[model samples]
Target: MIVIVDYGLGNLGSIKNMLRKIGYSSMVSSNPDEISKASKLILPGVGAFDTGMRHLTDSGLLDILGYKALAEKIPVLGICLGAQLMTRSSEEGCLSGLGWFEAETLKFQFDGIAGKWPLPNIGWRDVFDVNGSPLLSGFNSTPRFYFVHSYFLKPLEQDIVSMNVSYGFEYACGLSKGNLHCVQFHPEKSHKFGMQLLRNFSELT
Candidate 1:
């Protein structure tokens, strides 16, 4: 069964509800054993970088999840701040991340167009596939997903980027490498396209 990690840093109920709507059986728990036994895992987060990491560390899930997702190669999906936690570090906080990916989370810099758009880019934005990821499969065209973040991941390896979203500038929003998958957008809130993406993830081995 898919396990939605409850580290006190995410919208656990909403994610579980979304999974239910998609007809997927999932459990939300902070129990290490339950997490270790998961066929698939969803790491959901909605908060600051340091706070999320602290919660995960305190939840006693760090090592088990590391083994499952990294060593054992179990399929894992990280949403929003969860995705950022998969990286090495973040500009939002000084804490080191899970370091699963050789990437860094950076605050949005509007550069010359600073006043043109708002920070923490909220609302819907279209994401374009970069490498035709299985998670993005079955889509006839680019799909727009809900985004509400001030920072984005910058993976060192360009090949790992599954999709990108253009704000004031283009940034990597979807990352896939081996059994690990991460999306900056909230598929759980993105309507049909989001549901399709979640469905695709549920089907992954």
Candidate 2:
């Protein structure tokens, strides 16, 4: 069964509901044992970087999560802030991240185009598939996902970036490394596009 990690953050129900719509059953749990048994893991989060990390740490599932994602090598998916937390660190906070990727989260710097686009890039945007990830499979056309964030992930390794989206500038919106995958966009909130993406994830080996 898929496990929707409950770390006192994220749209847990929405994610579960979306999965159910696509005929995939999932459990929302903070219990380490329940998490350990998950066939696939979905790390969903909404809010500040440090707060999410703190809650996950306090939940006492960090070690098990590390083991599952690193050792067990189960298919792990992270959404939005959860995706940010998978990086080495974020400019939003000082606390270290899960460091699953050699990357860092940074606030959008428009520079010359600062005032043109505001913070919290909130809207629907098309993603450029860099490395065709299985999670993005079955799309006939360029898929667009909903995004709502001020900061974006910048990975040191260019090859891991699965998708890129343009806000003030093009940035890594999706990442994939081995069995771990993450997206900055809110697939649960993106209607058919989101549903298809989740469906693809459910079908992953």
Candidate 3:
């Protein structure tokens, strides 16, 4: 069963409901045993980076998650704030992420460029699948997904990065390497397109 980590920092109910709608009923758990035995790990979040990280650590879920990803190498997925935590670190509140993916999170700069676009990048935006992983099967190379954040992440290396989405400038939108996959968009909130992506991940090899 898929285990949704609940650190009191994510849109947990909406994600759970979305999964049920897609016919993938998951067990939202913070128990150590449940997480270790989980078929898939979904690290979802919807809050400040530092606050989320603190909650994870205080709850003892962070270490368990790290062990699962780094040692067991279980197929894992991260969304938005969760995806940002997958990177080495983030600039938001000087946050230290889970450091699973080889990327770094940075705040918006490009003043001239961002002036033309919106901050927090809320609502629907299309994503260009650069690596074409099966986790996004049945989804187009450029499909609309939901996003809401101020910072953006770039893969430390291009080889490990896959998709890119444009805001003020194009940045890594999805990241995948081996058994680890991360997306910046919220599939649970992306409607049909998002549903397909979540379904793809549920049955991905």
- Candidate with the greatest lDDT versus the true structure: 2
- Displacement of residue 109 (Cα, Å) in model 3 is 1.5
lDDT of 3 by residue, 123-179 (tens): 888787776666666864557888999988878989777778888888998899888
- Per candidate, the number of residue pairs that clash is 0, 0, 0
Q: List candidate 2 stretches off by more than 4 Å.
A: none
Model 1, stretches more than 4 Å misplaced? none
lDDT of 3 at 110: 72
Q: Assess candidate 3 and give its lDDT.
A: 0.84
Per-prediction TM-score, please?
A: 0.97, 0.98, 0.94
lDDT of 1 by residue, 71-112 (tens): 889899999999999999999999999998889999988768
CA lDDT, candidate 3, residue 148: 94
Q: List the residue pairs that clash in candidate 3.
A: none
Best TM-score goes to which candidate? 2
| Residue 134 shift from truth in candidate 1, angstroms | 0.9
Candidates arranged by lDDT, highest first: 2, 1, 3
Candidate 2 residue 78 Cα shift, in angstroms, is 0.3
Cα RMSD for candidates in order: 1.1, 0.9, 1.6
What TM-score number comes out for model 2? 0.98
